[model samples]
Target: MVKARSVVQRIHLLQLALQITFRRTPLGVGMQNECWGAVAAELARLRGETVVAYYGISLREFRELIKGNKLTPAVMRNRVMGFRTLRFAVEV
Candidate 1:
């Protein structure tokens, strides 16, 4: 059975996965594309959830979501709570 992870925990896990993925020096386009799935799988493992639970979309869709500034850390925090809409606030 999978243990439940808190919102903060999930967000932190995602951040770490992104950092790890970005730090890699992939050799080619193919390898670079594969990084997305790698990160998703890593995140799923950390959260004790299936990759589909975090991102039910295809790898391309997930990549676009991240690259298009659609999925920020703040937005992910809301997503963990079942909120789909993105929210932004001036951090002070």
Candidate 2:
């Protein structure tokens, strides 16, 4: 059986996956995809959960929610900056 992961842990895992996409070298891809939406859908299927627990949401809803929401370290940094400045601040 799979061990339960706390919300913080799960979020951190997604963040790491996204951070892997950051380009570290020219012509080399740091990560081709930060596929949170895909992973959650497949994992839920593997666990035989028709619907996600705790969140009371379905795979389809999860996909829609996470769409374009790549929560990487860089992305977090940008968000933190915005909060600190109380304004929209991000580089590209």
**What's the lDDT for all of these models?**
0.41, 0.37
Candidate 1 residues 1-92, lDDT tens each? 33354465456444644454344343112224433345555666787866545533345544553453223343243232122212111111
**Which residue pairs collide in model 2, if any?**
none
TM-score of each: 0.33, 0.31
* Model 2 vs. true fold: TM: 0.31
Candidate 2 lDDT over 1-92, as tens digits, reads: 33354564344334433433332421111224424444434444565654256224445545543543444344443333223222111111
lDDT of 1 at 74: 35
RMSD of every prediction: 10.1, 11.0
In model 1, what are the clashing residue pairs, if there are any? none
